[model samples]
Target: MLRHFAHPKRLTLVAVPLAVLVAVAVTPQVRGQQGAGAFESSDEVRAAIARAERASKRADRRAQSLERAAGQAEQEAEKIASQSAALAARIQETEAEIAVGKGQLQLIARQQRALDARLGERREPLIRLTGALQNFSRRPLVLSVFRPGSIRESMYLRAVLETTIPQVRGRTAALRAEIDKSRALRAEAEGVLRKLAEEEDRLSLRRTQLAAIETRKRLAARRRGGEADRQEERALAYAEQARDLDGLVDRIDAAGALRDELAELPGPILRPTRPSQARASGTTTRIPPSTSRTVRSPSGLRLPVDGRTLRGFGSVDSKGARSEGLLIRAGAGAQVVTPAPGRVAFSGPFRGYDRIVIIEHPNGWTSLITGLARSDVNVGDTLAEGAPLGVAPPDGGAIGFELRLGGRSANPLDHLSR
Candidate 1:
């Protein structure tokens, strides 16, 4: 009787430590995933892959759409810049989505591996239980009489076996169900991985195409290397003269402030006259000067692009780095426009900000737009309210904007109309 019970008792002791070990091992990972994002189900993984795939497909469509739009663009620079920027952005966005899809696939693979191990751990106990049940079944109750135990003890053993058989069956059924689920999960995970691979391939193709375009552009830019070198030397001289970005911006803002202040002053005006009025007046009858309306307020300005605001001023990302502006996730190939009239202070790439456009508005306010693939406006250009400044790549990703008052960054929400 002791021998018959020994295996199960040993299994119980083993299971306790095994379960504890598993808990100890899994706890950190579970907490890590929780901190990363909510755990994803198989369906969720598939959905993420689908979303990424869709984004790639959209990027393809966007590239073609931008090409067609560029053909109709007003200026050659605008056309080439528009097409290049949009293509580059679309490629970047698709690459990011593909990366996310791959991450999901990896997560699913880990879950599948863990589940397989769990099923494996249950196998030995299940085998022993099944063997014991089969042995008890083979040796009928009549054989207990031949065994070396009291009749009462035999009866108790029989009763205990009868109760335990049902419990074992129930547990076996549950384990089997779980095993089936794990298998299904693994199958689904495999499918997700395959889908992600296909997406990665598609993104790779887009990247290749982007590379070809950039290669051509680089060749063109190299043709201007001589002039570019002189310009670079001048810029370097200025940078060395200014010392830092803040000082450079301050110097630039100082010049812009002078222009803005002079613009605020009334200039000498000479009204035109018709010949009939000139004859009647002996020389000319001056036309009435149109009264200029004051634009003193920074209210009622519209958003630069139509999209959801992902992050606001002071919001931090996964790296805990706070934003200095509003991050908007806009439509693929969407046009980014000026929120208000301003003079383009700088329109070129800045480190980490991508293609950017900075416009100095009146009232000491300057609007900085970033994350564009191409800048439409150039420095010293006057952009009217809602004037197109740049273009987003197809498969629209993040576009950031900062509202600076006197060179100090401020929350754009506070200034933009609701």
Candidate 2:
């Protein structure tokens, strides 16, 4: 019986399958024995999972926020005169969605790689076990009795097979589960890709719409003649004369104040037709109250662009120069809108600040925005609150917004609507 058990063919058939099963069962133990230097610990795995969950949550929140902002901008566009703002908002929303989709695809890819690694860990062992099992099944039981072990040895082999077979089955079940998870991840990646394509399509549509609206506006401005040109020339002159940004703001403020004063002046008085009729009228002449529009505070003003503030009002920069306005880091080609109802005092390039816009609001309030790649509105264009002023630089550049009351810089955040 010992000689039969030691036969090369019998040993290979029994030993190979048994060794494969043993390897599969003790893989975790072997890995643990290898120490943390060789493999990740349980704590490390849990931390990685936690970070992935946090990133997914943040992506979800950002997508929701962009959706809400897009809806709000669409409503505002319907109420305002300019449709470019809404189109720009839509384009931004689509870009954000596409970005989120790409991120999700990357995450799915990571999960697939992990699953592949896990499957690889058991793949060779499972294949060996399967081949050995097939060989044993193909051989006749009566032939095995004639060629190898005695009845006692045969019974011992049968007992080992009973134990090992069940373990192999369990391991295979776990592998199937992992494979199913991998399939699900692949499906999820496909879904994200489809969404990304849809978003790209929508972005293209919005860009086309915005271009058409901008073209119409330009044509209308041109038809209005040299008045806007003259105003822009005057604003350029002011920009040239001013030594610094503050000086330019002061000059614009003074000009606005003078304009308001001239508008408020009374027209020539008219004489009454009859002296008796004039006498019958009240002797006391009552002056009408000024009807000029004004905002007492910036409490209800919208932010010029949707972004995070890189530098707040009064913050010092690398140059040790205090910030007079908010330095916002916005997405590529983000829409810039008027914060309040105002007239365009200056809209064009100034110095090295790229394209800039200065909006003159009522009651000595002024808004200055800089770092635009393009300016939609010209000088002397009257705009309602939330009207499209322009777009930020295409490469996700930073833009500056300064709010001044009576020629003094103020924190825009302090008065923004909650």
| Clashing residue pair totals per candidate (backbone < 3 A) | 0, 0
lDDT of 2 by residue, 289-332 (tens): 32344547653476677655689899998889999989987667
Superposed Cα RMSD, model 1: 10.1
lDDT of 1 at 406: 64
Clashing pairs in 1: none
Task: Show model 1 residue runs off by greater than 4 Å.
Answer: 1-65, 71-78, 99-103, 106-167, 221-231, 255-406, 412-418
Number of the top-ranking candidate, with TM-score as the measure: 2
TM-score of each: 0.50, 0.64
lDDT of 1 by residue, 124-198 (tens): 765565566455545545556777774567567656764665566556565656556665665665665676678
lDDT of all the models against the reference? 0.60, 0.69
Candidate 2's C-alpha runs over 4 A off are 1-82, 92-96, 99-162, 168-176, 270-295, 298-300
**How many clashing residue pairs, candidate 1?**
0
Error of 1 at 271 (Å): 19
- Candidate 1, residue 245: how far the Cα is off, in Å: 3.1
